[model samples]
Each structure stands twice: as C-alpha cells, then as structure tokens.
Target: MYEIFEQLLSERGVTPYRVAKETGITTATLTSWKQGKYTPKPEKLQKIADYFHVSLDYLMGKNSSLTTCPDCGFTYDPSYPEDIETHIEQHTAWEKAVKEFGEIYSDGVKCEQIKAENRKISHDLSLPLEERCEAQIRVLRCLFSRSLVANSYSLDHVPFDTYVAMMLNNPSYRKNNLEDDLLQALIDKYGTASGMNSGTIYHIPNKSKAISTKDKRDIKRDLDRIMEQLSNQEYGPAAYDGEELSPEAAELFRDELEIALKRLKLINKEKYNPHKNKK
Candidate 1:
C-alpha cells in the first residue's frame, strides 16, 4: 500500500511534501503510511485517488484490469460490466470483419531495393516537387508491404495497423467514405467506455466510445469544418512549393487534423474517458 502511494507520487512528479501540501494529508500521516505502521483509511485513500483522478481500488494497489482483445487488439477490462458487454460485441464484429473486409497488418519492413531508390531520390536533390511527393507516397506503400489496395489509388498506399487506424485524420470525405469500413472497425474496436476512468484507459473521444448523439452530429460538423479549411485542396507537386514541408508547417497541419478529429468525436481530451455509450 505504501509502495503504491510512493509510486503514485513518483509518477505524478510530486514529493511527499507536495502531496501533503496539496492533498491535506499531514506529513505524520504519510510518514506512518510509508513506514507501514498504519493502513490508510478509506477517506485518506479517496482523497489521494481523487487527486490522481483515479479509483480507490487503484490507490489500494489494485492491478490494472485492461487486457488486449485478440481480434481487434483494443484494450478493455472484463471486470467492468460495461467492458464485458462491449468486449464481446466488438470481438464479434471484428471476427466477422476479418472475413468481410479482410485484413491489412502493418509489418515494418524496408526492401533493400526500395531503400536504395529512396536514398537515390534523397541524394539526387534535383527531382521535381511533384515527383518527390509521388516518390514519398510510393515509399509509404513500399514500407507497408501489405498496404490496402482496395480504395483510392493514392490512399490504398496508406497502410494501417491498429495504431495508424487510431490516428486516422483524413478530412476528405472521399477518403473517409472510401475507408468507411476502416473507420467503422476502429469505432468497433475501441468502442467501449467501460475501463476508461476507473480501470484501464483507452484514449479516444467520448463521442466515439459512449455516444452522446445517435445522430452523429459532431462528425458532420467536423467534416464541414475540415472541408472549409481544405476547400481547395488537391494533389500537390510537393508538400511545399519546392521543398519538403518544414517541421513547423507539418506540426501545424497535424494540430489542425487532431483538433478536427477530436471535435469530430474520434478522440478524448482527458485521461478519464467518462462518456458512456457508443456513437
């Protein structure tokens, strides 16, 4: 118990002194706990748990309940009733999806031939911007040898494992529509809000997990905003006029995409996934 308390303090980057100051747990009380002279009462444990935005069970040294689903690879706890419900549901969906949509696993491999070609392209430094963009996309396809080839020609090159699917932020309706099954699968995989707050956490939108609106309004709103932002977007010669995009520019684009995705209700803002139903 004392070890768990110490771990919490350490993980939060706070000293026992700071914890005492902020949580109003006296130094003597904490010291007693540290020495294992006394077990912390429920009230004290509650305060500490609340301070960490965690559960009392967690403060009492309970192990995380999360386990990875074999089919979807999403994490959820069987202990939580809600998790068990959604767990079985998603697993079933994914089991069916495997046969229906097929699978594209991400295996990070670089062929020597492709690697040399990429190197040659980089070393040459005189390729047209359009050419470079095309080359980079090709590189994307090559790296993910099992890239999905069903959808759009260019987009088929964009492969995904669970992580990549989790981070999908394409604002284009064409991309989203083409990748409808993919998005649905993601929603199905990380669908439950059961283990979010008090159990194991999965970072995703409240709107996504426990759906607030059955209408799915947020998705449409976000799509509209994305369309507005990228109203005239098209295939470009390069990421920039004549050079690869600058880090700042790239970061800004990422930020915009993240904001849109979250607003679109595909991500969560906090460690506590409090939302309760699926969108």
Candidate 2:
C-alpha cells in the first residue's frame, strides 16, 4: 500500500509534505504510517484516496488484484489476465490519439491542440470534397466537445472553420464570439451567425476601429451571411421590391451596367510588373 502511495506521488511529481498540506493530514501521521507504527483510520484513508482519485480498496491493498492505467485512468482487475492484456492495448491506442491529435480539455471549447493538419485539411480544395467536409466537422467537434456544448448544437453549415481558426488564434475574436454566444448556441439561443443582420456589415468598412466585442461579433456575423448569399444558387430580396421588378429580372440589369475596364491590365502591370514599354 505504501509502495503504491509513493508511486503515485512520484508519478505526479509531488511530495508527501505537499499531500499532507493539501489534505490537512499531519506530517507526523504520515511519518508514523511510513514507519509502520500505525494504520490510518478509514476516514483519513478515504481523504487520501479522494485526493489521488483512486479507490480506497486499491490504496489499502484490499484490491491488490486490481491495476490502474496511469495514462488513461482506467482501473481493472489484473486477475483477469487475458482481458487485462486487451484492455491495456486499448488504453495504448487512446493515449496515442490524445497525445498526437489532442483531446478537448475540460475548461472550454478551445482545442489548443488542434493540429495544423486539421486546419490545412479544412481549406485544401484539392482534397476530396468529403475529406474537406470531415475536416471542418472534426474541428467543430473538437471545439464543441472540449467546450461541453451539446451534440445537437448547430453551426448552420457556415464556415465555422473561419470563425474557429480566428477564435483560437486571436484572444479578442474568441472573447467576442463567446460573449455573443455566437457559434456554440447556434440553434436555440440564436440562429446561425451567418444569417443575421447581413446587409449592415457590408458598409462597416472600418472593421479595424476599436469597438465592443458584441459589435465586432455582429460585424463578423453579417459578413459571413453576405458571402453565403453570393455563393449560393439563390436570390431572395430587394429592399424596395414590392413592384413587378422581380429580383431575378433585376439581376439581368447588372449586365447592362457591366463594362470591361480596359485599364485593368494597365493597373495590374503598373503595380506588379510594369512593362518596359509601359503598355
């Protein structure tokens, strides 16, 4: 029992004095236990067990047959030798996944460990469409699971990758989004951020101006909606369109206003690689 106790202390890089301080047990009592002078009462033993997060029986050698995996915190009976081998193998797999790809931490939806590979996969157009979709979903899942959001939460098919990447990298962006309840509570608390107040964001060109977090989040929300509208195969509205001006027909009028800027190449050449002749 003392051996197991010392092993846990060694594994956690803590000392008996620290444990005594934290658990409110006296150093003298620990010394007495160590010197084989006395056994601690069940109540005291339970406190130590709780601190270490192990079963009291295991701590006291009452369950000497049981073994706990240090990495995965899985406890099982070593007496079941055949099953123990299989269980150990499973723990190895999970431990590797957690260390390599990162798991959601307990505090929030922040995936500090979200790998660059996952981010690259989200936007790499050359990959299979399915792969890209999975990458995006995985990123959100990492966020949601880590943050303890429910499984039914919605991102409304928005490019959450954009918001998530920024949120993770930038403290201001993340705080604003959380305070807005922007992406995590997408379905119940509010609809998708992308579909709300979109037109207003377009003209707010001073995005760099100092503003409150909610204001910044609102601007981000509406901009995403604009991108959504342009890319989707649909048109739905006009601010003053009760007349016979169907928006579909109104769209054709855009062509009437379209003109080739013959100076386009001149501007690009002037800026990028001005021709020797200054074409």
TM-score of 2: 0.25
What value does the lDDT take at residue 265 in candidate 1? 53
Question: Residues 1-279, candidate 2, lDDT per residue (tens digit)?
Answer: 678789879866799999999999998998899988988888988898878766677688774465555544445565333335545554664455354444433223134455345657756768765566556556555553332212111122123333344334444434433322223432332223332121111111122222322232334445445434543446654322354345565454333322212233234434553223321
User: What clash count goes with each model?
Assistant: 9, 1
The weakest ten consecutive residues by lDDT in model 1 span: 149-158
Q: How far is candidate 1 from the true structure (C-alpha RMSD, Å)?
A: 22.4
Cα distance off (Å), candidate 1, residue 212? 8.3
Residue-pair clash count for candidate 2: 1
Candidate number with greatest lDDT = 1
Give per-residue lDDT, candidate 1, residue 126. Answer: 74
CA lDDT scores, all candidates in order: 0.49, 0.48
In model 2, how large is the Cα lDDT of residue 85?
51
